[model samples]
Target: MRVVSLVPSLTEAIAVSAPGALAGVTDWCTHPAGLAGVVRIGGTKNPDTAAIAALRPDLVIANEEENRQPDLDALRAAGLQVLVTEIRTLDQAFAELDRVLAGCGVRSRPDWLDAAEAAWADVTPDGPPVTAVVPVWRRPWMVLGRDTFAGDLLARLGVRNLYAGHAERYPRIPLDELNAARPDLVVLPDEPYRFTRDDGPEAFPGAPAALVDGRHLTWYGPSLAEAPRSLARALRAARR
Candidate 1:
């Protein structure tokens, strides 16, 4: 079936899950190098509905947390069947894909999930219960605090979130406040931050620091195939 995947993570998912079925993707959907030439439908939150419509897809895949409400309704109104997914945990991700594939009449999720789970199991889930801080944005600087997928993923790896004391999922935090909190690991995401190794080891000389790919940590869709490995890789890189 012809499909337009507006969700960025699903771009990776479509590569393994549905293969050539994707007709269009959001600008952020750049995982599979082959998608480089595909039409860019704008950002994840603001897709070009006209471009999506011109693709004439039989199905459009979106995420509840990723896309705005109007986008979902507008796509549906265009008479294209839409599949919306919301995932809070790994199980939820699998469940959603099950529905999505079923809706598309595919009857199975892409095989990457099985491999991901196996890879996740190989990690032994044996890691120090370190405290971590994940910065989402800069300038007024916000951070993921509690009940977020990053928080849960850290919990799974036996790491606890330092800012989880806050009520919001992502709380605005001052750099000084974070410094004082003394997290075992201070994380900077690629988005809203764009941290690079060139910034140097002495940048946060007091603690372990890492510049992580935000999508791998937070995207709970089929992209999870890479997540378990990415987390383990991140933790190992932290040793330096």
Candidate 2:
């Protein structure tokens, strides 16, 4: 079965589980190292529908949040079968991954998926929950708010998002307001915006900053298996 994946996480999952099944993928699908010889449709937000349709894929995988509706509509209007997934929590991610793989003709579950579930299942928080402000973007200062997959992941790891109750899933706040929140820790992921030690921590002043892998914190694929350990280590390192 030929597949075109618009979502990076889904692309990695499909590429790893069913090698060579993908005929096309977005330019953002950067995992599994050297992904060569595949058609690069475009970016997630602005995919080239005509280029994708020309690929004649049996399935096009996408996410509700990562992809735009008009693009999905354009693909469907061109007679392409697009599978759109919604994942706001860990459970949803696992289930959606199962569904996506099944749609890709993977009858048996991948070992990595099983291991990912097991990894999260064995998690035990080392101490009380740490209150943190998670910044996904820095220029305008957007943060993870309510009903976000990243926020849910952090919650499972015993880090409570200060903006988890905010009306917006990702709200842009002023710099002064963010510092005023006075979170115990500042969690920075290196994607959407790259927040390094020198770059991000200075703004938070007294708050310790945990610099983490954005893929582990955001992507819901094979990375999930190691996210628990890697994220825990980063969080622990910040305290040390």
**Which is the leading candidate under lDDT?**
2
Give the per-residue lDDT of model 2 (tens digit) for 20-55: 899998888899888888999999999999999999
Show the colliding residue pairs in model 1: none
lDDT of 1 at 173: 81
**Which regions of candidate 2 are displaced past 4 Å?**
none
Q: What is the lDDT of candidate 1?
A: 0.73
TM-score of every model versus the real structure: 0.85, 0.98
User: Alpha carbon lDDT of residue 107, candidate 2?
Assistant: 84
Query: What are the per-model C-alpha RMSD values against the true structure?
Result: 2.7, 0.8
User: Cα lDDT for residue 27, model 1?
Assistant: 76
- Against the true structure, candidate 2 has what lDDT? 0.93
TM-score of model 2 relative to the true fold?
0.98
Tens-place lDDT per residue, model 1, 1-240, is 888887776667665666677788887876777774467789988898877988999889898778898988888888878888877666677677677766555666457777766765665555557777777766666788776767777677777788777888788986677657777777766764676664323234477776677777877556566776777677768856
lDDT of each: 0.73, 0.93
